[model samples]
Target: MTMEIPIIEIKGVGPETAKDLEGLQIATVEDLFEHFPYRYENYEVRDLSTVKHDEKITVEGKVHSEPSLTFFNRKKSRLTVRVFIDRYLITAVIFNRSYLKKQLQIGETVTITGKWDQHRASIAVAEIKKGKEKRSRVIEPVYAVKGNVGVKQLRKIMSAAFAQYATQIVDALPEQLRTQYKLMDRVDALKAIHFPLDFRQVKQARRRLVYEELLLFQLRMQAFKMLQRREGKGSPIPVKKEDAASFISKLPFPLTQAQQRVMNEILSDLKKPYHMNRLLQGDVGSGKTVVAAIALFAVAKAGFQGALMVPTEILAEQHEVSLKALLEHEQVKVALLTSTVKGKRRRELTESLKNGEIDVLVGTHALIQDDVAFHNLGLVITDEQHRFGVVQRRTLSAKGNNPDVLHMTATPIPRTLAISAFGDMDVSTIDELPAGRKEIRTFWAKHDMLERVLTFVDAELQKGRQAYVICPLIEESDQLDVQNAIDVHGQLQHYFQKYNVGLMHGRLSPQEKEEVMVGFKENHTQILVSTTVVEVGVNVPNATVMVIYDAERFGLSQLHQLRGRVGRGSDQSYCVLIADAKSEVSQERMRIMTETGDGFKLSEHDLKLRGPGDFFGKKQSGLPEFKMADVVHDYRTLSVARDDAAALMHAEAFWKDDSYTALRHYLEQNGVFNKERLD
Candidate 1:
């Protein structure tokens, strides 16, 4: 197959052009095929009078006069061509292309395709071709090019490459599978993707590509699941129904029905013969911690140690206090280990953990360190699962022998995405908030309403309720013109001099964060000014008001999380979003936040609005960056791909048949398929 053929081997790609293509990670023939269009331009013929400003169109016209050239600055030139089309006059502007003077002759019947600029009353020429169209309309692909590579130049190179080596492009999916899915042939898909006849063709091509991308990804995850099973045998820890009920009964508050259901699912997994890789998803104030504490208690009662890893030191500290208090009567010992626990204290914790003196250990990433060994590690629970990378989670689990792993994520992922991303794991959701939890009333307001908002917050403070003033940044940034927590803290302090104001951000030390949180939790601080650090694990029930400054800069999921901090208590809470965002997208995000408090629904909205890349940020959500597959937009296709992957994983043809060579080879080349551990 020509899949591995280097771009340099292609006919028009010289060393210079190859190096330029390399910038966009297109070094091989397969990469060229996978470089899908960022957008498409339809060259539908349009008359000058019918064309609107900012609309991209192709207009065929005769040059009315001799083309003129104007020099703008040194090394900069502009060419102006006036054209007569359908008894209407239109101006075409070309920049820095003095070499085009010869081809753009007077009275020449040329076709121009470009965006009409209303202000300049001219069209910025994207492309100009002499004569009329002899073929059907072409949907030109616009690629994410780099190194000054023109669209025409890249298209020409791709055309030549396809004409020469397309036949060698083997289909990664088997013929029967492709037929079952009714997908376009791999070669035809590549061709249509690069140079489609119409928008329908583009969709067809994308459907095939998206399916292939997602299928390969799912296959990879499935392979990982198989590898995990081969690693070691799991210890089936027994869970008594009475024990679980006792643990829940001992909690300060009764568990929600949803929490009880999720707890049952988790306990059932712990008792399975195979190791559990389950995801526990819940919204804010859903009592996920109480459920986790119950699981930890069950594990401890079964004569095994359990470890809980969180993202932040402060969160770990908070969990330790709560869990120890909840399980102290049960004789379950809980220990806290973080970076701050150093020297003699760290060694003592490690020794205690290794000697089974500590029934449960809670810490940050430090729990994965080599010295933190567990005598009988039965279960591993990671809070804020997205914050920790897959390797970090694996490292902690590796400390135990096939430990039942329960990943807890407050970030609600759409079910389709969760299936596509974490297909290997089972999922349990605490869909309902705890009983007595108040519904947070959300409001979107502009900066002009700040005075009234502050007054309202002051009133709330007088009523003995606390508030949170959240900012996007910690300190003033020269580049970003957004509200900073430090400045906002000072402003709020001055506004409400009688009420105490506390400051918190990611930059604060663990001890400092703990101190600030302690003040806010105890009501010593009437208003807590903070960054997104307070988004997770800080439960202050009396905080009835949440004022987020510059809320437009945040995503829907984040806004939902901030709103979650309030309404934890029985008091009716309010979340005020203050921003001057004028963009349609920003306005939509704010509107969604004000419309619903459901995290799962907000997450689905966020995924659809913001692509998965921006939604997950720089971290890997156990999902590969597909070249074309969109988790939200192509949700149906993703499901089909997942189903296909499951069937393939179970089929003997996928493993032993020679016809499946390409699929196996592709997976092997990408290191997606793992060799079974030789136990």
Candidate 2:
């Protein structure tokens, strides 16, 4: 393939237009080919008489009358055109698109796609083509354009580019793979994706491209895994079986079998010669911290220090309390170091940490500061691992000589995605909640049912139970109609006049947040109105009811986490999801939440409903975004890709086989073979 040809060479692209295309990353001919449509317009010919009201439809017709523009309001205008289709007249309305008035000429043939309005008997034009070309029913590609580049101009440019270079685009996948996966060739797939004659072609093209993308990603992950296995040795901290049992005996509660299994896995990893880079995945309220504390205790008993970095100050403080209580019998000194600790007290804690006087250090991002030195740091664990990136994790581990690093997350991801995203690390899941943990009964209600929900909350409070009123936004957003914590706090205070209401948001000072959380924890505040700030590790067993306002705005995993806050206690708990969601996707998300309390299932559902963006947050998941591949929808293909990559790698000789040369080169070009990433 002539991949290096510049996009500027394409017809209709001037210097200014090239700059606009560059904004969307269409630099070369290959990039233009890869610039898949964000969406498509269905331009299939349809009968106007059969069009449903408010349903988007496309039909070909001849302009029966000259277009006329009329002002509906001071700032709004509409362009109306009458068209004749099969001897029937239908009106097309172009609102705020008055510039099209001159283009809609009398007796001109055109094809238009828009919503059909049965009341006015008009078509609300969304898109229109000038000429009714002799083309079959097709889905027209809609490029993500900017500046002066309209969709029509971009389409013409893309058509010219494809004509000039389509045949030159060679298939990256080998013929054997293409046959094994039943994939269309690269050139055909690209052409069909950009300009498909039917939905069948779109499906074929998407399947082929999604498979290629997953195959490349799996290969890259496999390479990283191979590199990690060959990296430097780690500081080992082997523990005796009797010692581990003794450490567990000091716990306030017995560890669940799942927790015990994961702890054993961590212990075994520590005993290995190579460094331990493991992910500890557990659902909210699953007692992951207990297992983490056990691992830290083992490292401390082996005469080495451990550090646990969390995302929030309150969470860090909570962990400090829990760990101190759990390990005090062993005389392991636990220290808390956060940005809030200042003056001489901070210096004293730093000195203690440097001199090994502190056996375990738990804090927020403050643990990664340059001045924060450690004494024989053997294990480093980051709680709420998704909040921290790979570099941040590496910096903390760099504090020691290749310390055994354990990443802990309360948000559970599906097994396949976990394998895809964190293939570099070994994974252990604490699937079972601890014994005696009560499952929270979830309820879904619209805003109209708010009165009933508030009554239920009052009843729960009267029974000596606390409640949480979670709002989706910190402040009222001008764009979104979601409820805010501040406003909700004010309203709830007035509504529940007898109960104390507290407000919390991300904008609050650290001290302020701590004060509010402390108030809620001590039960002085009966109802805490807050944003998702308290979603992670704000454990209050006495809090038995969680009322989430505008719950439709939150992801399934977030909803699950919010529900976890209440179900921690043995007393019966309930999660009230107040959402007047109008979209089918939001309704489905709410329904799924009410049906099950499983975090893993919720996460899978969330991925399908919302894409991987909610889970990965764009680039932080440590994998580049695929142009066409969807992690949730194409998970089966992803597994197949992983299997194929493994098979190919195993068969290749010393990573230099002729069949693997193109794959290896692609990986290297994309920095998948970077030594630092491997390390």
Candidate 3:
């Protein structure tokens, strides 16, 4: 059998260009074929009357005036071209195209295709071709590009690559799956992705590719789970009901039904011999911390050390304080390990952990550093698991051999994403808040409400309460000139002369930031003005008010998290969202926040509004980008894929089924296959 040459073998693609293509992970001809467009440019010709303002359109008309050129700099120039159609003179601006001035001859007809900006009051032509004998207009494909690479160049190279390697690309998916799913062949799908025959072809091709990607991902997760179960190496920690019950009895408040259900699930997982990897999900002030404390107690009863990793130093300190209070009478030894504990204290803590003197260690990423080692570690828990990458979580867990991993997140994710991201782990959700917890009163206000909001904050402060005034930016930029944290802090200091104002942002050093946070947490500061750095793990019960400036700039999920900072205490908390955006999508997002306090529901709505890109910021998660699948829109497909994966794995015949070799290979190639497969 002769193997086909990779896409790099294509002519005219030098080493530099090939490296650029490889940045997108397109190395082989097959890789290139699988690389799909992020979006399509529909250059279908339309009439001038059909061209809406601020929408991309393709129109053909006669040039009514000579093109004019304006120079911004030596390297920068803009050209304006005018065309007359339907008795309307439509002008198009070609930015950085001084050459277009010579090409656009007066009284000549040309077809232009590009985006229309009403602010510039012109249609900017991304591509200008002379109107000649043309068969049909091509709907250009727009791929995700990297440094110095533009859509035009990518399209040209991809077209050439496809023409040469299209024949060699084979369908990796089995024929049965393709036929059952009504999917197109690999070659046709690739061509349609880059140069679709029509809109219907684009849709169908997209469906086929998304299904394949999601199906493979699901299969990989299933395989990992199966492999783990087969190994059966989990340490069984016998749960004593009295141990958990006694701890809960000491609590000031009764456990909600939701918390009890989650506790039961955790207890069950601990009793099993298989290693437990579970996520404890809950809303703010839902008492997930107490559930975690119970789990830690159960692990401690089994004479195994447990570790809890948080994202920030302040959070680790906060957890230490809370946990110490909860487990005061327990025989388990608890120790705090953060970057802040330095010199002799840090050394002593590390020594205690290594010597098994500490039964439970709580800290941030410092706990997973090379210098830190745990003695007889058996269980690991992470708060705000989304903030830590998969590799970071794995590293922390690896401190103990196959430690039962428990992750907690207040950022409620939709079921589809949760399964997709953490499919191998069992999930326990604490959906109910504790009794006497009040819903945070939320409102959308404009700039005019600033004085009123400030007055309310002052009133709250008079009651010996604290408030959070969050700004979107840390500093003014040309792109974003919204109110910054430092500027806001200074202004607030002047506005409320009697109240102490503290400031914090990402720009501040870790120590400086921690100091400011401590001040706010201790109520030494009446008002804390900050940026999104407070988005995760900053808990202050007395902070009854959250005022977010330019709320429209934030995504719905983020807005929800920021709003969650309030409403943690018994006080009637309020969240004020200030934005001038009246756009439908923006308004809808803000409306969802005002209408519901359900983080999971808000996440689902946010998924619908912002799509999967904003759901978890997929780019930051190191997950492969989807070309066409809207994680929200194709959730049904994802569910189907998940079910199919489960069924296929459960079947007794799967182990011996040769037909699944391609899929197995696909999973292995993507680095998602279980390590047991190598054996």
Candidate 4:
């Protein structure tokens, strides 16, 4: 016999309410049990005298006066209420709640709870009840609400679900492991997460749950990696040490020790029978592209065609130019394919690719289109790997016979995140920058600094050098008060009319964008005022100044990428960040740019400050969205989990034991085991 839980046994959840729950991805008792609270509300009771005007608190006071109502707008039917707590008066305003006037009688005592607004200098009551018998706790669980699902209602449903599922909750981790990690039982942790008696209990329970989630995820990743190593089919493409040395010797500058180390690792992986599914991560201007080009050349020399896929047409074009120049001395044919390539030219390129006439092909998503086919494609390279989804990468990989994949990214991801997000692939890092590159001078300035910045740009332009002016938005929107690129372009044109000004944005056509980019590159336009469309490409060697407007609106990595546009040339460059907002996080993010040029250090700081989900847009990557596990605070746990997963997978006991059965089930349910189904 099974004990019936109220939420599970009760059959009267209406379709409308069910749809609201579905929006949160909660449809059953199990889903409700796992729907953790985003934050906790600690309502500490305080006396009226001790109550701060703006601080949130719960107080019990006698109502000394009758509630008074005032009408603000008859058109919108807005009303405000004034109530006195003892002798001190405080206002409780509600929108479109004029009907509440009937409930508050003269000199009636009531208990109210909500956030205290400093602007109004009153407590904004979110919930109110009559009589003095109401009991308020010190700690309150604030859950994400659905339609008709208030905190109290959500608590009741969760309580019922926990009662039923507590016994059914299987421990994913072994008893010894849990004890060693100082973690609570899975069932107890879930219960405490939903209904914690105190803040300490909540914190402890959250830590355990976060550890478990990460541990299971790490286990699955380790298992998948092992399976891939065992079963993956790959052919070794051999290259002599002298051949690699000759290629590196021909480069304009000497390779950094870090770059040489990464190349050697890739060379070893290529020599192995198993295909290489490796991620090459480095800071902007860390010489990732050069390393990738070397690997492509090696593969090409091995008599296998290689393809480089980028996210945008401009990046595709840029890669083609860079790779062609790098491999020009070598006997290899490289071709570019983009959406812009039309009719006869497209047909010719496709025919050449299919016939193995082209040694290397570089293009955007056009490479994966149904009409596009490859001949003897043995290696694949994707720049800015995070921009492409898992399905998109798989689609490109499927173009060839499961070719060896080498994904590259300029955005330096934190170690914890790298393991969680790209756990299925081996990682290589280029930790050092190339020689002779000067660190770009970065500064954060207020609006008052604009004139000085413009004067500086004018001085640079006078010397025949170019500059880039980046705006956050393309067009004006009534919703946001941000400065648009078009408005900035007009202002710049008026201010710097003597110099040519060019504009580019996502709204502009490909032809118009190409024209402006070409002008900027050729110095026809000394100042290119544009949006982030130029963030990925549009490299101008003569440009030495980059002024980013509203720098606070950009992520740390993105801001780093924008700054990378200028410092590419040999001459000294300056990046001026103009921000009006004075948020602490924003200030810290900007400070990272000024303080250090290391992309990995900045990324670690970003993860610590912004958390994982916010660092990577929730919908952008298929990596699991963490609710509580912070990569910064949980780094130790992440390391332990990674080690534990690896050790367990290597143990012969894992295959025979039923202890990991629940973990395996969880992985399968999350689709981590099935690589083919990721798309």
Q: What Cα-based lDDT does every candidate model obtain? A: 0.85, 0.85, 0.81, 0.80
Higher-scoring candidate on TM-score, 2 or 3: 2
In candidate 4, the residue pairs with backbone N, CA or C atoms under 3 Å apart (3 or more residues apart, or in different chains) clash, namely none
Between candidates 1 and 4, the TM-score winner: 1
Model 3: CA > 4 A from native:
1-4, 8-28, 35-169, 179-202, 224-234, 240-254, 330-333, 337-358, 365-375, 386-395, 423-426, 475-479, 582-584, 614-619, 646-652, 671-679
Q: lDDT at 522 for candidate 4?
A: 83
The estimated TM-scores of all candidates read 0.86, 0.79, 0.76, 0.80
lDDT of each residue in 1-679, candidate 4, tens digit only: 1122323353445666666667777766666777888887765555567666666666545554455566667734433456666666777655556666788775777766777775665777766666663444567688888676678867776676665567776677777788887889877888788777787888889888888877877887887877676666666777565777889899988999999999999988887876789999988789998998898888888888899999877778888999999986798789999999989999999999999989899998888888889888888999988778878888988887667899998888888788888888888999999887899999888878899989999999888889999999998889887779999999999999899989999988877888889888888889999998887775688999999999989888778888888988888999999987689988888888889888788888877777777777666646676666766688888888888888877877665567766665666666655633111
Candidate 3 TM-score versus the reference: 0.76
Native-to-model Cα distance after best TM-score fit, residue 193 in candidate 3, in Å: 5.5
Better of 2 and 3 by lDDT: 2
Angstrom error of the Cα, residue 90, model 3: value is 17
lDDT of 2 by residue, 1-679 (tens): 3388888898778899899889888899988888888888776788877777898888888999989899888779988899987777889988897778887888888988889888887888888788874566367888888887889888888899988887788676877888877889889999999888888999999999999888888887777666665674775677665778898986778999998899889999888877888999999888888898888888888888999999888889889999998887788899999998999999999999999999999999899999999989999999988888768888899899888889998888887678778866778998888877778999999999999999999999999999999998888788988888989988999999998999988999878988999999999999999998888867798999999999988889889988888877779999999999899999999999999988998888887777776665565655557788877777899888887877765664526656556676777777865724332
Whole-structure CA lDDT of model 2: 0.85
Query: Candidate 2, after superposition: displacement of residue 234 in Å?
Result: 2.6
Of models 3 and 4, which has the larger lDDT? 3
